[model samples]
Target chain A: GESVGLHLPTLSVQEGDNSIINCAYSNSASDYFIWYKQESGKGPQFIIDIRSNMDKRQGQRVTVLLNKTVKHLSLQIAATQPGDSAVYFCAERGAGAQKLVFGQGTRLTINP
Target chain B: NAGVTQTPKFRILKIGQSMTLQCAQDMNHNYMYWYRQDPGMGLKLIYYSVGAGITDKGEVPNGYNVSRSTTEDFPLRLELAAPSQTSVYFCASSRGQPISYEQYFGPGTRLTVT
Candidate 1:
C-alpha cells in the first residue's frame, strides 16, 4: 500500500519567514504527488503538485520538491504569511484516478 | 462551476443510528471520492466512484457504504454509526480516466457520533 508521511508534527515560524514542510512516501510507483492546505473547519485545498519526472515545481508562493531517489517530497513557502497557517498534507497517487493516500499532516503556524 | 458540493455542513448521530452524506459536483467530473479526517491522522479514503453505476471501497471502507446513481452525485451511507465514526467528512471530484487528475473538494461535513 502507498502511504505519505510528514516529518514534522508542528512548526511555528515568525511572519515573513520561509517555512518548509517535509513529506516522505513509501510508494515508488506513484507518479503524481500533491500538497494540500487544510485550515480549521475546512476541507483540504490543492496547493501544488509535482510529477515524478520533475524534481521541482512552483506555484503562487509555494514550491514542491520531489526527490524520487529518496522517495521524499517537500513544500516551501516564501515569506510565509499569517494565511499560510494551516495543516499541510502531502498526497500521492499511484497511476490511477481512484484515490490519493494522504500524509499524517504537519500543522504550520505563522507567528506575527 | 460550483465544483464539488456536499450537503449537511454538520451532523450528529447516536449509536446504532444511520445517516447519509450527500455529494454532488457540477463540473461533470466522472470521478468522485469520500474521505474522513481525524486529528493528526489526515484524510483517509473511504469510498470512491469512477462513473455513474461504478463504485469501490477505499482504504477505510468499513462501516461505510457509497453509491453513485448519476454522474453528478456520489453519496456515502453509514449503516450503523459508531463513536469511532465521529469525524469530519469531505467529498471531492476529479475529471477521471487515464490522465493525471486533480481533485477539487467540497466545504466539508462535520459528523459527531455519541
Candidate 2:
C-alpha cells in the first residue's frame, strides 16, 4: 500500500535552535499536504499546510516545504521552544479524496 | 467554541465487548473523520464522512463502523473488540474541500482492551 513515512523516528534539539522534520510520500496523485503536532494525551493539532502547486508555505513560527518532483516534504520550526517539543506528522491527501493519509511521525524533543 | 468534543476520555473493555465512541463538533463542519493511533505510530484513518448521510471507508476500516446522521456528530462503533483494538481514537472535522486540509481534532478517546 502507498503510504507516507518519516525520515527519522526521533529528533533531539536544544532550545533556541531551529528544527527540521522530513517526510517522504509515495502517492503522486496527492495534491495537498499538511503538518500536525500532537502532544501527550491529546489529538493532533493542525500546524500548517501546502498545496502541490506551491513549493513552500509559512506560518507564524513554522514553515512547510514541499518537493513534488521528489515526493518529499519538510516542516521547519524556528527558535524551538520547550512547547514545540512533540510528535510531528505529515499527512497527504490524494486528488478528490476526502481522507488524508498520515506519516509515521517524528518525536521532537527539546533540551533546555 | 468547544471545537470538537469526545465522550469517555478513557475506557477498559474486555474481549468480545462492544462500545461506541461518541464525537461531536460544534463548528458544524461538513466533513468528519475517525482515526486510530497506536503506540509510537501515526494515525490510521478508520472511516470518514463527507457530509450528513454520506460515509466512506479509509485506510484501516476493519473492525470499525461509522455513521453520520447529523452535521455535527460522527460516532465510531466497535463490535467484538479484540486486544489489537486497544488504541487512542480521534475524531476530526474539516470545512472545505480535500485541498484545504485543515482539520480540527477532538481531545481523543483512550481505550484498552483486555
Candidate 3:
C-alpha cells in the first residue's frame, strides 16, 4: 500500500517569516514528488516538484526538499505572506504509475 | 486557452438520481483524469484515460463510469447517486505520463446527494 502523510495538520506563521511543511511517503520506488497549493474552493495548483534524483528544487519563493534516504519530503516558503495562506498538499508518484498519491493537506495560515 | 473546464459548478441530487459531470480540456493533452476530494481529505483518482478511446479504472472507480470520446472531452457518469457520493469532483489533464509531466486541475464540481 502506498501512503503519503503530512507531519502537521495546521501551521500558523507570522507574515514575513518562513514556513516549513513536512511530508512522509511510504513508497521507496516513488521518483516524482510534487507540492500543490489549494485555495478556498479551488483546485490544487502546482507549486514545485523534486525528482528522487534531485535533493532540492526551488521556485519563485518556495523550495522543495526531497530526502530519499528517510523517505521524507518538505516544502519551505521564504518570506511567507498573507497570500500564501492556503492548504498545501504533497503528492508522490511511483515508477511507471499513472496516478499520484496525495497526502492529507496542511492548512497554512499567515498571521500578521 | 481554457486549460480545463468542468460544468455544473454545483449540483444537488436525490438518492437514485443520475447525472454526468462534464470535463473538457483545450491543452491537447493525451491523459485526463477524474478525482474526488472528500472533506479534510486528499484527492483520490476515480478514473483516467491515456488517450482518446482509451480509459482505465483508478484507485476509486466504484459507483462511477467514464468515457473518453475525444482527446478534449472526458465525462464521468454516476448511474445512481448515493449519499456517499457527495463530494467535490475534479477533472485533470496532463500531456504525458504523470511521472514526468504535471497535472492541470479544473475548478471542480461540488456534488451533494441527499
Strongest candidate by TM-score: 3
**1 or 3, which is superior by lDDT?**
3
Instruction: Name the weakest run of 10 consecutive residues (lDDT summed) in model 3 chain B.
Output: B94-103
Q: How much of the real interface does each model capture, measured as fnat?
A: 0.82, 0.91, 0.76
lDDT of 1 at B48: 89
TM-score of chain B of each: 0.96, 0.97, 0.97
Per-residue error (Å), model 1, residue B78: 0.7
How many clashes (backbone N, Cα, C below 3 Å) per candidate? 0, 0, 0
Model 1 in CAPRI terms: which quality? high
| lDDT string, candidate 1, B12-105, tens digits | 9999999999999998888899999886678989998999999998989999999899999999999989999999899999887565467899
Q: Runs in model 2 with CA error above 4 Å?
A: none
**Number of the top-ranking candidate, with DockQ as the measure:** 2
Per-residue lDDT tens digits of candidate 3, residues A1-112? 8999999999999999999999999999998999999999999999998888999999999999999999999999999999999999999988888778899999999999
Winner on lDDT between 1 and 2 is 2
Each model's TM-score, in the order given? 0.97, 0.97, 0.98
Candidate 3's C-alpha runs over 4 A off are none
Worst 10 residues of 2 chain A by lDDT: A92-101
Per-residue alpha-carbon lDDT of model 2 for A37-98, expressed as tens digits?
Answer: 99998999999989899999999989999999999999999999999989999999888877
Instruction: Give a tens-digit lDDT track for model 2, residues B1-114.
Output: 999999989999999999999999998799999999999989988999989999999888999988999999999999999999999999999996833558999999999999
RMSD (CA, Å), each prediction:
1.1, 1.2, 1.0
